[model samples]
Target: MSITPQAQISAQDKSYSAKALVSIALAWAFDAMDFSILTFVLVDIMKDYGVPLTLAAAVSSATTFARLGGGFLGGLIGDSWGRKAGLVISIIWFTIFEFLTGFSIGFTLLFLVRILYGIGMGAMYANGTPMLMEMMPAKWRGFASGLMQSGFSFGYIFAAIIYRVWYGDLGWHAMFYIACIPALVVAIYIWAQVPESSRWRKEKSASKSHSVPVSHLFKDGNTWNTIHAALISLIAFGVTYPINIFYATLLKQHGHFSPAIVANTIIILNVAGIIGNILGGYLSDIIGRRAVLIISAIGTLACSFVFQSISTDWERNLFTFLIGLFSIGGVWAAIPTYIAEHFKTTVRSTGQGTTYHFGAAVGGAIIPLIVSGIAPSVGGLAHAMTYSVAITSILVIVLAVLWRESKGSVLE
Candidate 1:
């Protein structure tokens, strides 16, 4: 049957459910935690497994490259099979590899395992963001999207807690092990608790009667959707990726900080991010997604400069917090929700996931190589970051201006 009349909105669309939002948010948090956990423990893994800093970074980059593929595959699965299927499989798939990475004997084994984990992660974002966005009321789409994206901050904070309590004594393997518990728990929760995307199921059945899938997105006015979302994803992470991924590395190498200081700095950055996620999410509801992007781009550009200037512990803590808040916490408030607006339900996850993960691959995996490669000649990572932020922020603003604002628009 079609969407019930009383519950129907924006034509036949149904109101967003809190249950779906919470389920997707929890799953997204574990995905974020999975990614963040590795970032915190990478240095120790390098020392333990006998690899140089460059190789270790390459291992991380490899996972990102793999994710580009994973995201596309997962998006297809999500759109074709069901969001719940992709959701459960991706969570369990990644967590298993994450647990096994702890037992790896060499860089090759670790690299292969992480590549598989990246695949799972790529799928997670593809499935999770669209799954949640498709279910929400247009009025609360920004709020719902931010709630799902904010899981990254929660995951980062949890990873920091692991580093604070266990990194000194238990080491990198234990950090990977800690991630397994949550992964298993959440995977079970998702299968047992979360419902499939009613929207996808309804549309899928409708289209099958015609035997040809909806072809509107690939042509006409919507042609640039996939490209636009991907570019937006790339720019969002332009500063966010390098800043968070290299937080520990930058503080230790550039600022000459001890391990204790680095851990504290990470925690502070994520704490500020949690607040910014909420603030930006609500503001997008009030102001609009484009405004949130402009505000975030400007904030990230300005804060990145301050972030590069850190020397003292106070400087590191304060600036790290600001960078996290502005670069990701704010931009994330609207990005996934905004991207969801670019496509109808059938291709929503596909468009959002493909571009977003490709962006992640570039931002998370590729950009660091450029910065680190130039670090020796450029004075340090700080100067490289300053230049990157200036350039990326302008690009992000340009995209935000050009991309239509989708605030309060109903999902099709």
Candidate 2:
């Protein structure tokens, strides 16, 4: 049972991969916090700026639309330069804008800063995810993917806490200012501790050209994979945005819940979401990615129905937790790993960024606008969101069934 030198190196790499995961997840959590803090305070922004619901929704949508460009640029930078470089730059870029969001003197300025912030947000995922996937041991990829995605939920919880503590007295601007500090720390940690992806380095050394052409994404029968991935991402974003963006507002204005109740309920939702993310990732590893996705989609649909139908305060809390678990948590856990496996190492970041952000632009951006616009006619925001979730969940189940499974895919 003597361990060979190669075996020893493999063991060391696995150890380093776990460390890298923490650093990346920290960056992801802060990114999520910065993005989600705005949602919790959307109504406050509207009151201060004297904008309509649709206009407030537009600010969120504008950020998502900008992410489309940011994602593309991040992927290109990742593939051309290095994952670390792409990630660090994206983090710094977003941190600056998120800090500036507090300084916005008017609705127009807030909108513009958020749009700029969206690019950095988009880029972080494009760069950080591929790096983690490449570094993680094959056996742990599913769990790692789930944990990484859970950072977003963790961030939402962070946002909720900050909102509850600071929004009433200090105002929304202080929350944004507070977010900048930890994010900068995460950026520094990643730069210092997280090593470049070995797979990316190997690819760079072997390739003649430093950059992979984006055109390659459409060639070699990959166009279908590209289209399918984008459609899946679009569906995920479409279902998610309507609910995540509006749920806080719904609790306050529609349900007439007090601020504490709204914030506490959101915290509960994300806690369940965090559990779902980890469970979904673990299940995907054992059962297969498509099966987990299908299960999550169906579960999400069922939970949304219960969540909408429930009447009592405790019942609402119970079902809201379920909605977060299945819809927000479970469905997203497998996405990064599933999407990353669709492309070769050379084009992985670009493919992921382009497809994910395309979905963000079309599904994430447009669906919120539609929901906000139709809320009055559809009976209310809850009705509109429920309908959107039902339709999109069906799409997710279909797409998961049709999509080729990428489990146990070895990175190039």
Regions of model 1 farther than 4 Å from truth: 1-16, 209-217
Model 2, 318-341: lDDT tens digits are: 888888898888888899899888
Best by lDDT: 2
Using all chains and alpha carbons, the TM-scores for the candidates as numbered come to 0.92, 0.97
lDDT of 2: 0.89
Over the stretch 1-412, how does candidate 1's per-residue lDDT look in tens digits? 6766665644434323676787678777777777787777667777887776667778778888888888888888888888889888888888888898788778788899999999998888888888887777778888888777888888887887887788789877778888777777877877886778778888888875433233655666777876788888887777677777777777776677777777788878888887788789878999998998899888887877765667865666777788788776897788888888888877776677788888888876888767667766877777877777777888989998898878888778
The per-model lDDT (C-alpha) reads: 0.79, 0.89
Model 2 TM-score, 2 decimals: 0.97
Give the C-alpha lDDT of model 1.
0.79
Task: Supply candidate 1's per-residue lDDT for 307.
Answer: 50
Over 4 Å off in model 2, which ranges?
1-4, 306-311
Task: Please state the error at residue 160 of candidate 2 in Å.
Answer: 0.3
